[model samples]
Target: MAVETGAGARAGMEAPALEGGAVLGSLLDLKADALGTYLRARQRHGDVVRIHVGPPGLRMDMYCVFSAEGAQQVLASESANYRKDNPFYEEIRESFGNGLLTAQDADYLRQRRLVQPLFTRRRVDGYAGAVAEETAGTLASWARARDAIVDVSDEMMHLALRAVSRILFGADADATTDVVHRCFPVITEYVLRRGYSPLNVPRTWPTPGNRRAAAAAEELYGVCDRIIAERRAGGDPAEDLLTLLAGAQSPDGEGFDTAELRDQVLIFLLAGHETTATSLAFTLHLLGRHPEEQARAREEVVRVLGDRTPEAADLDRLPYLTRVLKEAMRLYPAAPVFGRNAVAAGEIDGYAVPAGATVVLAPWVTHRHPRYWSDPDRFDPGRFTPEAEASRPRYAWFPFGGGPRACIGQHFSMLESVIALAMLLRAYEIEAVDTEVPLSAGMTLRAEGPMRCRIRPVRR
Candidate 1:
């Protein structure tokens, strides 16, 4: 989708356009190879490229903006000029209905405000014990297979699920976690595939993917409903996000209706676990490949906590691990591409943009732009040191995204990641099984196969 309109370049007033019939060819490239397609587009077409995407019979031209300046324009400076009207957001609502993610403007603000209190400093601090416990539990499992090659991706996914399940529901999630871990990905992958696919099939058509997604959703929703039902019946007697949510009143004073509560819970389950899992897997893979950084992080763990389990306060003390995680996210962001439909005709970074055109903001592309980082592909955590970070543009390295509509769970994600990574590194020495893991782009950036690593328990 690299657009090189030499004719338009001479005119100066017009944005470059993709040549004739290249749209279909570009569509094939995007579907078959997302990371390569975007990376190549940036290489060939500069930061701003025009491409067409949609079904075989129907297509809509969209701008793929790669520059940090363009990213700022769409996500921050003129954010109001854009809205979540894309197929991607609509499809997410299939499983995560009207949660903060798919909700727009006033509705999004309202929900964010309602849920914001759940992550207040004291409340967030309280979840540390549970997070550490789950980390220990996962480590226990890993210990049984010491020195064996393990799939870091699989282990991290389950660890994240168990931890988020406890934090979200505020109690034992053994049964619920099994159900969610079993079925949530089924629905999410289907929605993601449909949202990005060229042929837009209506979910009402009952195709195989749709049927599996629907069945998985029903089972997932039932688990949610059961949790709500149990809490109402005085089950567990614990105060968690669910407890407050169960009694949470709307801005107008009505507690959320059953459907409303369901939406919020479903979003937490999917967003809370899946994204963190992916990030952790990438973190481990990076650490496995970079042994020196791994050793430094391990040294910090020893100096800070010795043999004790990492507590909430221990997170801030491990600055280097934080940097390592941040750098991994820079290279392999969980949600690689985010789009907003233009609410009105506008110009972005000198390009004419029409109303309703999808403006794509890709961390996958911007995070690697040479102007923003020296040797952008290098795995250097020093890039995130305080002085180094302040030297860079704010929007240049957004893994969780930016502005008023930024990810609400970012604080929770960082805290959880710090805890999980610290605990894992403190316990094991990670050796890379392969020189590098192949990358793929989806709803999340993923390793195309198991990110295999050999783990040895720390002798100390």
Candidate 2:
């Protein structure tokens, strides 16, 4: 479709085509309204669409594959060829350095191997008591503030951050929470803005926002560094992630240096909490909107553990709650869009993808694909039931991604979500105050405004 340009045209050039050029431009503008444009293109142009967006000579391709087979191909089968290389990583790498999330090739593999054990099911299960205690405490506070509108997004972030800090560092830096909280918003704003803008500015340049973000990054690093130094000086051998890493020795009997330790800590603090917090927030939003499912989940939780706190063993009994989280992730994946740069020439479902081209596989698109889902847009947790789930293909629902580079924190996040949801539902009945709020995409998919809800104590 041809659309008129809002601005005056240049002397020698005609207006950019709306179907491709103008649509691409809107994405670069980072306007929330551009979502419909992208969705319409997906509907009209099939799975893969090409547009010229980035710097000259670099053509970006956007893939909206809604098939299980296609998702598997991109994430699992040919994953090695697809490493993270995009504007998102470019901005993150500035502050985070090449930690596991941003590392590639041998560096990535080595780091992932070293850090993988800390997030194992066995290790994560050990933290269940800590998770439950923190969650119950948070819920008690929420209950005290009866009938007040709460930003579930912020609440979840705080809860997740606390759990992560307790498990990872074995310390509760409540006094430092204010400083850490202030730092993230600055980083998030700068990264999101830079991801979309066309203006290329050096980070060292004296931009007010850039300076603030840099200072925040430095402050965050300083806090982590001090903690590490103190732990080293005290020389207490604990099973926490930080201590585990400190004592960890490779086959060659080597351990991470100060710089490497700082990088890993920063990556964990950012990736570990924010992603889980977003998932939990969206899950709660879904539960509020779907009262029937929420009730079913609560019943399941109550039946499993009458009045006691949930333990690691109780996780398997709460099948309904597990399905609920799985379904929520499908609708609003924390890391909705993932990209990879092609290392060599490849073909994705018969399309000739050239070498060095960027390939994107969006769970946001695939999870709701009409071909795989019965009613793609509906909130149906039952779809994740064992029989129903078995009927679907392997990669049909990958909220935590797939294959080697899949999120190492998947087990930890799932355990945390289950515990948090069970504890919260056990205490309160939640209902959405406004169900019409639009879903906005950010660092993670979140509601544009606070997900206001009414929480009443559930009568035993």
Candidate 3:
């Protein structure tokens, strides 16, 4: 059925469309190269594009909204009409549990209430010590490398995982960090494959993907469950995130049950580390690719702190470094694309959208929209300057998304990125050895190939 258009706007339009090509080809593109496919659609079909996938009887219609205004409507102004009922979210909730990221309605409200205080600006700022300690450890390991050529991506991943792990688990972090690092890829890959599959079989079936995902989920959940049990057994309580959750209660004095606790931990591990890791990795890689920007950022870092590590207070002082990180997020948002199910028919950018249609909001495309960004492909941190940013629509750069359902850990992610970047840049001079990073859009953005950079000790 054709989507009905608004009477006065873009009359008779059902959203511009891209040729779906062969059914098999469309399915393959959606599964394997969703980012590239979305980019092609946006470039060809303006902001509100209609995509038809699958055969006539079983087709799925995806309304791809790329304009900043359209994104605002879908994500913020009219967010209630868009819900986390899409197939992608279903796949995630199945594997990762109905935690904050995937929860809806009553569950979502309760989770948000219980978890909100833990991520507040004051509370998150208190975790800066963990960020600094982990960053210092990373720099020390880099100093040991004989050739000083490092996989910046891998290094940042480990550093971020360790940092957030410490903040979450405290003393038990040492044991959990390696397990999470090993299992997350397996689980996220499973989520990605199943999330995009047009037909998903039962997990009870012994398919290779299902078996791997099951094993990963088992190990991942087992670790969190064990840690939560230990914490709940009335041991010496530390000031970690896990402890906070263990003690957190709603107004009625209700707290998360064992299963709920595990779910929350799983989500924190996924969002807390993965998103920040992507941001840090890309920030460092972008710095490597742009030496002038790197040098300027390094100079600011040095001027701010000659030899001391950065704390939460230093974040505001490091303006140039913050811009660099923001620009990197603009180019490579960790959660590159997310989906919502339209609760009712609505017009987006003067194009009518039907109820129950899948809506895809792509930061990968919107961040590069030509109308909002001048020469969108360039690596220009200046685009994020206060004056320049104030000139654009609020949703023009929503790497962390917008509205009430926005990332709960946005403050924490920024704090981790700014600290990690400042500490690393102060210690090393980076140059891209493998400049072009082939990317894949998984649960988060991933560099499909190695992003290696050669680094030298910065002379005082």
Candidate 4:
């Protein structure tokens, strides 16, 4: 075979390129509407597109892959060639510490081995009682606001934070719930701004944004550290996630140190609540908008639970409701876009991908790909039916990502979300007050405006 290397391979690269010439090509569009920009790029440029951003000397290449096959390749098949060494991940590592989410190589392997046991189906299912208790509290609050508008986004955020905090810290949850709720928005917004910026002032600088974020980080980290210290002092053992995490030890007696524990706790606090909150809030919003689906889901909940509080075991029983949540995830994935850096030269869809370039995978786009979905934009829970799902590619709906580095909290997230949704639907009938929700792509997906819904007590 004839050789094609270097300039020859570069010239024959088959990917379509979108050039955003000079200082900031597509940067503004990305900042303003990341989801829209990515969707449009996919629609116009097909599954594989080479996007050019930044100015002359500092120009950057993003090999954007929107196909399900491409997602599987990058996230699973050829994962070794695509590592999480990109600027976005670097920012996350800097802010969150090298927890399981950002840990690489041997560090990731060790952490996963130790932490994997805590997130197994049986272990995570045990947290169902905590989820139900928190949901009941939220239901009580919603009952008080009967016939009034509630910001579903904020409400779900609070509900999820309380549930996860209680599970993670047990008695110490109260100390951090309000602090995390107050500080996360500021911290996440700061991360999004800095993570996407072509250039940034040092976080150590006393700029207003830097100072605000630093203060938030300090307060957040202090509370977690204090709690972890107290737990390590051989105090009364609480049956919480932290207790389990601290108790986790390897065959050689290795375990997470105090600092490592803090990093893991921080990542859990971020991923555990934030993603589930988004799922719950968006599911409610979608259900509220589509009353027929809402009625159907509620009907399923009633059929299955019959005025009883939902448990983890009930997750599979509530099939229709589960589908509703899945549909919501399809429309508004919590983590819309994630990136991986090419460790070496590769080809996606026959287009040459240069080493060191970032490959972006966006569930927000892939979920709606014309090839995979019949009515891409419409909200339909039936799409998740077992047979329907079987008809599509495996990577067509990867809300939690894929492969060895996939989210460890996947089952926990589902258990929490399904239980909470069952309870919420059983307790109240909600109608979306704000029909349209504008989104801001942050470290996670967020509603740019209030996702308000009017709720009335369900008449038995």
The candidate that achieves the highest TM-score relative to the unseen native structure: 3
The per-prediction CA RMSD against the true structure, in angstroms, equals 3.6, 6.5, 2.9, 3.0
Which ten residues in a row are the worst by lDDT in model 2?
6-15
* Model 2, span 90-139: residue lDDT tens: 77777777787888888787787777766678888998998998898788
**List of clashing residue pairs for candidate 4:** none
Estimate, for each residue in 1-460, the C-alpha lDDT of model 1 and write its tens digit: 7776633443334445544254474677677777777777788877777776654557777688888888888888999998888888888886678887788877777787788877676778778888889999988898787557789898988998988888778655876888887797788788788887667678878889878988888888888888888877776678878878777766788566678788988888878887899889888988999889999998998899887877778778989989999999998899888788998988876678888888888899899999898898999999999999999888889887787778878878888899889889988889879667777777777777778899988887
Q: In candidate 2, residue 5 scores what lDDT?
A: 47
Count clashes in each candidate, considering only residues at least 3 apart in sequence or on different chains: 1, 0, 0, 0
Candidate 3 residue lDDT tens string, 406-460: 9999998999899989988988999999989889888889999999999999998
Candidate lDDT scores, in order, read 0.82, 0.75, 0.89, 0.89
lDDT of 4 by residue, 237-351 (tens): 7989898898899999999999999999999999999899999999999999899999999898999999787888898798999899999999999999999999998788667
Residue 460 of model 3 has an lDDT of: 88
TM agreement with the true structure for every prediction: 0.93, 0.91, 0.97, 0.96
Candidate 2 global CA lDDT score: 0.75
What pairs collide in candidate 1?
A: 55-198
At residue 357, give the lDDT of candidate 3.
Answer: 93
Query: Candidate 2 at residue 361, lDDT?
Result: 66
